[model samples]
Target: MDIDDEVVIIGAGICGLATALALHRKGINNVVMERSETLRNTTGAAIGIRQNGWRALDQLGVAETLRRTAILIHRDRTVSLDDGKVHEILMKGEFRCLRRKDLIDTLYDELPSTTVKFGCQLESIKLDPNTSKPVLRFSDGSAILAKVLIGCDGGKSIVADFLNVKPTKKFSFCAVRGLSNYPNGHSFDHDFVRITKDNKFLGIIPIDDHSEDEKKEAVMDVDDEVVIIGAGICGLATALALHKKGIKSVVMERSESLRNTTGSAIGIRQNGWRALDQLGVAETLRHTAIAIQRERIVSLADGKVEEIPMKGETRCLRRKDLIDTLYDALPPATVKFGCQLESIKLDQITTKPVLRFIDGSSIIAKVVIGCDGGKSIVADFLNLKPTKMFSICGVRGLSNYRDGHSFAHEFLRIRKDNKLVGRLPIDEHLVYWFCAHPYVPGDERNWEDPEEIRRSTLDLLSDYPKEIQEMIEITDVKTLSFSHLRYRAPWDLLMGTFCKGTVTIAGDAMHVMGPFLGQGGSAGLEDAIVLARNLAQMGSIHVESRRKVTVQGVEEAFNLYVKQRKMRVIRLSLQTYLTGMLLGASSHLKKLLCIVLLFLLFRNPSGHIDYDCGCL
Candidate 1:
């Protein structure tokens, strides 16, 4: 476990090996550790390298070798997959499709003997107290101390944790690339082709003639029967529900990992618990958070308090726990991380939904479910108008008191001067709280940092109880977040269509409402259960007949899902809208209107949480 190396690299992919080689040329000793038994060639069959890439290869002394075996691309074409529109552009610079194995092999061959240590998996990294150097611990229980560490370990790198780097933002699309052989000469010109429609894209590049006239291409795979976009709570839950019914689905998430920890916590009531129970993760998740017994409403003006008993099972869970539990319940490889959806369109021949990703890859699915959130690209494909934002914004975070506090296990809400502050205990030592207020023009100028947010929140509550002030002041800044609330208009949900062909939407993509009702998370869970139930019934029919899911059959199922969910979501949206109006209304007339509507439509405020989404 003792080493004299000055630098260490954790990966032997193209980047890791290339970095080590660069360091070697600079007279720096470095070791590249690869967990794989050999170099990876599964990335793709070939890569299209342009002029800059060739220059980089030249610096590494591999350009000439690659040039000898790669075909030059001279022309470029952009084709619209939707409308059959084609535009051809003349090529200018150097571009070629070299086999990825060729490049990887060349890099590996050029490296010094024994430079890469295979089968070394990095388990943990900590700083040496004496030398201030990084001490890397491998899974084999060996440790190495190095002066510097470089992470070229692909996207989900463990080394990233050592640097405290924020996770990369997830996009809405992913890619697929492969090598296709054409023993018979292909008619394609010595040019590259870029095909696209909406957010979808495809690229085709030819390899050298000596390589069996092979071409690197990105095309849609027609084998995917069910494709769910997003790996959030709704997406994973839906996938799990389907899996429970013997229906397999691919959950495509743009993020490299599970749900973002920044979502803080989510309150799951009876309906959400029902959905989780049906998904087979409820029992395990229940131990993560304590259940609520009652809701305590406090009025700041008169120090008055009112309590309402919480009826059914209700618990506040760390969003990470819920997402992790749901994900862990499913079979391996069921969720495909980094598969961001770019565009989706109906195939002219089969009429099935074809989804394209930003990574130049695509897949055709018999049924496409959009569990993507408020800014859903799938909803856009359905031509649904975007959700509207409210003038009110919420600042939320977690407050931890290491020394256990003596607070009741109750959901507390306090209101004064049109501003509302709410707090609920996550456990004996942790609490989740939120402050919502009207949007003041340029007020965010003071809320830039966590300290600033804390300061502003404290100032806003200066006249309130001292306990509240102390809680806000001592909150951990990393958990602080502020954003405006947005919701789909109630009217839109009533009259708008939620299904097109065999594609449909769920969760926030379907019915996004304000937090007034606290039903957003539960509603999405309900969506997963209901949607899976309908699909299971439909899939059972197909299984009995030994036939594939037809477009008409899928469409019928989606229509039924919409039919069952439409009015319920509309009612939920309307209630949240009215509640927001009651709090943020600028004039007396609007306030009266909202109050009247609330009383007429919702006789009981907590009635929304009483219903169940049924079993999977």
Candidate 2:
């Protein structure tokens, strides 16, 4: 059987579905092919919603929905673990978190149900070289013809295969996530958390409320409860974007929740803040989040601290608070608590792309977006391999004290040894901290054992001020987490040619970098919005219009996506790496250089940090 349309979409994940919604809003009707028989209830734990993602959601008319479900996070606080000295940084806006499913569901709600054809696995496409129309055949023996096709199928996209496109895996970092109930009256400020210990790192994001009242309140109500991975801040922001879109997401971890461990916090830059604002969660974030005004570097030998005020606006958010806001904004159906993607394969030939599940069922889609994270299937399918640009380690956690205890007001601190430490306020009663150091190969101690990790971390910080030790001592092993840090270069051969025919990639699929600059999810969301707009402007999907839909058009758009993104992503990645390097510097000369650089660059209070959203 054969059908015709103006366009055919190959996946139904975030990018795919968002593209569909965008097209539909533009009055472009098309068939959305999915490999799965039903909408996926479980995706990943959480994702960061930077300005780009929020802009896309705003175009979709669901920014309010997302805001309703997400908690606004706006400030960044960093402090010395030894002296309780603080530095504060302020932001133009903030970010939030939501479960993966919540975001998916919200996007799904905005589309026509009949537009998505499930269980139709793409087998192969016979492109009429003369007209450029694609004849799609599915594993289920279904067929269709379309003037244009969009792969939005994710990093492991068959469309990329058909087009012979591949992405280079820039880095490989596995993450574990979980969620838990926030104790009643917990009163933790709504914020995202980041912490570092020795060279290990962990992050915590608060999600929507877990109870009935939370379930019924506006998605933005701070009561929504959920937690995400203990890794970094990007994933948590992605989750917030989804929830703001009115989808419900839950982050299920292999281990216990971050509340049970120590976590890290990071500063949210304007790039990410724009994402939260576009989603309409910026107001809430601005109210409860902490502002980071400066970053200080202390000389280990002389105990002299040099202060550099932040040039641009930034916020320090508790990781958990960001996650909880996203969780609250989403629909409950959005997330699958314990489900994991074991394996994936593409149908050889099909009008619609098909994904075979390990559960013995198959999913057919117009596209499959792989937000499955760093070790993404979409990235693998595109043949993207991880690159080793920078490798490091980090440790992090939260510490509790009396309500009146005064701590550092700033958000980030670097030592003469180049070790980096930061603190974020979760509430008046608690503070989160993190540490980062250069990776030393062969340092294999079980990091999962909180006790062992804590002992090692404290020993490493022994040279720090006594206040830092006091905080560490008061913080039990149960409140700490650890992990290695790795990053990839922004531009890669694979990302240069990310799309083939109807398939394309987004998020970590195209570019994966270190989390220091916090633009990972921000970039992905930008990709989604740009791709959606391009597809919307392409018009109908019918065979008659196929000739008018030139390969040049698709190529041009894809190229533009890459060109607009490359420099920005590269700059952010490099900035993050530089921050890490400066923190981990070993030599006196290097430390002095860092100080000089800080004074030269960061000393200016009027300096501006610009990030282009590529909306133009």
Candidate 3:
């Protein structure tokens, strides 16, 4: 089957099918290779195709089929279980939920059989250097060369690997859904209700095919809610995600007030951008956020600054802004600021845990999520030990860019001796910087006091550039923070387990490592979305059915979450550690060579961007 000159598409999922349809509409023929004998039905679950997707379908002349076959959800209802408050939202444009199979079938029927090849899996991919075209090799030992190659093979894509852009796959959450035949209209006819619970989120929609006369019965004797520990970014994001799905959760922060002193700024790459955009949290922060353009690495030994080609939708924003952005998104009562965790007791029979707060109040939780920091109690409860420490420590600070500043909207990195320092401009008036260096064996006072942290920071950065030293001096003396850089080995997460029973961990609780790649916060944000999605699917029963959410359901979700996320986090942990080592090289000549090699290898930072998190 060796062929030449055609648009070759791998995988027949939504993206592939849509691309095929779009191309066909323009009178362009394409060859689609599907690994399976039949089209995938998105695991037999109903999924919502928003207005933008509907518009794409319209362009392909299949919008009518979709509208007729799917349920038209004109209105959406969100319920808060904590306060029992109902908020009605008017959806604009075409919003519908349909069986994934039905949508796939509609698109497939429009295409000619000659255009699609089933049971043809991609084994390897190559590009012709002379012709500059993509060459594909299939599992059946056949080959084809295409003018253009589109890899829509989902997470584990061979074509993506060929392009050197294969994503590190992870499932931070789980989703279990079922389709119900409702012959008659119920209370939620023509409407979609998103209900929040204690342990899970239930998204119930009324399908168009209702029976003429159906008796309405009460549904839900099931315990579906969650108990969230640690009201930090991860916890708040998780709470908001659950709330959006109309799931109930009690967010308990250990401190009496919102936690502060977050150590300056943080970076959110394309992955974080897409997640925040999908979660409806990115729009407002755009004004205050700085779009990072290039990464400037400085050789402190000779003061040679090299600018690497770094681009894409990378953003640097204040830590306070990120915390406030996530924290304020939730309803006022969603987070109980002063609710500290004193004791956790799990019932052996039900697997439900009773949480005792320091104030003497207690709540029994069916599912508990630990979003606490590196020293996570939930991790200990689940038998996940603290990450083994590396011989490095990290110090970070934020400075007031009171007037006009020199380094705004850039990610500047400096390497001197065995120390690595970075300055990222978060906004016009603020800058965030961090130093990762060899840890001192005996001196531990810097970990406690901010003044000592400043002194230790100065000692480490003895003869840095003037701007770098001045930024450290201008930092708020109270806000300087230090921590031991520790990481769970890749195998530790791959084989060492993350959850037990209904108790699990999210974000830093599950994978705590050094912040070398600046993806810890982004991953945490993504965790909120993934974990909420999986928990929501566990409660996707028909409104008229009496199916109690079980502990087994929660465990199934946790299993999928761990399985999906383990490898991705492990890859990120190793990349971050290796990057820290390269940048913290003690030998000047070795550092110069590594920087040159790194610039050549990772110059296009776009390849390192986080884009795959939103699809799940």
Candidate 4:
């Protein structure tokens, strides 16, 4: 096989496609081989596109298209799904919500049609035993030779397999997702919504047309729409942020769609907001979100109801509306409808990554970002392990009543066993409720079964006030969702070695954390942005040494990438772990201590951490 190009890409997911576009921008037209028979569309809905992600999209010339379909949410409000009470928090500036399809379609459109080959599954790599150049063989018996290959294939990648890279299983967390149609007369207060019970978290997102009805009609658009995400809030928020940056995205869920469950009302702290603002989607979000002036904390056991004025600003927005806005902002091709990543491989000799599909096909790419989540295949391929922290389990849902609901509020009703319940108001029509309980590791309780989890949650909260108990009694089990909390260690040798040749990891693959600090998706987007920038800046000559183009430059660049991202990711992972520990404090004394410490340190000044990387 004769080498014909400078680079070859495997897979066509966000990472692969984004890398292709980046290379294209650098005047490099690489071949993108996808194993699927067609573009994938079934991977599920919405992902967070942070400021960093937005910057990359902007640089790729898809920002404006994304903005047109996305909803910019400046605020997040937490409300009691049971009591209709609200607690509002302001995000500095961040756009939330874009459908997965919208984002993929947009990226696809940017590439020259000739660059992508659909249904070209990689069978094996034929290395030039003498020269070491890589030859990629396809299932169809055709082959192409390339100087450099990138494994953008996901976890379980064949590219990684060929290179003999094995990823370690960190934690066992599986996610189920579903989408709901927009309801009539829905009052959406924030762009993103979150409800936490013990160790579980549920996120709701709003999706809508950015243009007014009349304008949409004038533009011959379809009816306004929104998506409800039942996964962890961080994942949902990441998708939302991407839309805020003007990248369209969509989410397809595995479970039955819950059409009647209204979107969530959650608050966004300063840390999340600042990241959004830097991404250039903050202005639009501010227009529709509610700013929080104070946070009211109510503890039933202590009879302590304190109204603490918010030091730094916080905002609230309706979750569904945010998703709708993000969807509207993105180009149609940005997301695929049902593409699931089954397996992946990283090929070092040929230097291109490959992905093996469940359907018996494959795709190859330059880089693979593991935003596929905690039990990520990419993480597994990289041999990264997760360190077990405490496990949390909880139930969440929306309630119909909405009287005396503040936009931003947190009611901590401490019952037996230190169980806590929180309520947030998304709008006048609905509230988001959460109940959390501690659990030991290896507990086999099924959190996804709403009826069972609801019963257990109610049992835990039975000793609370009559009002609280009444709210739980009347809650709808059909609308409820559950989650378990887990954390990955700050540093792992496997992740450090993920980039053997042309393969790398990102998002949850590198670090999966509990949703304590709300930085999960934000951090992942940051990774994508940073990696894209580094790859974009490196020239072909710079990527390869003159004397041994195949031997030196590529390895140097890959090594540099690992070094640059390691410290930052490790810092975030540690921060997330510490934050989760503080939030999940089981002892009453510990809770009191934490509350007092928070009041003393977090009241006068914004307690939010800044996200300035100071890197291009």
Q: Highest TM-score: which candidate?
A: 1
Per-residue lDDT for 321 in model 3? Answer: 74
- Quick one: RMSD of model 1? 11.2
Arrange candidates, best TM-score first: 1, 3, 2, 4
Each prediction's TM-score versus the true structure: 0.67, 0.52, 0.59, 0.50
Q: Write the per-residue lDDT of candidate 2 for residues 47-136, one digit (tens) a residue.
A: 768667777788899888877876766655554454556555653454777767678878888888788887567878878777677878
Q: Per-residue lDDT for 167 in model 3?
A: 72
Candidate 1 local lDDT, 190-307, one digit each (tens): 8799889888798888785532223124454655357899988889888888877777788999875565456577788887788788888888988888999999999988889999
Say which prediction, candidate 2 or candidate 4, comes out ahead on TM-score.
Answer: 2
| lDDT (Cα atoms) of all candidates against the true structure | 0.82, 0.58, 0.75, 0.57
Query: Which wins on lDDT, candidate 1 or candidate 2?
Result: 1
Per-candidate clashes, comma-separated: 5, 168, 23, 152
lDDT of candidate 3? 0.75
Q: What lDDT score goes with residue 406 in model 3?
A: 79
Query: Model 4 lDDT vs. the true structure?
Result: 0.57
What TM-score does candidate 1 get on C-alpha atoms? 0.67
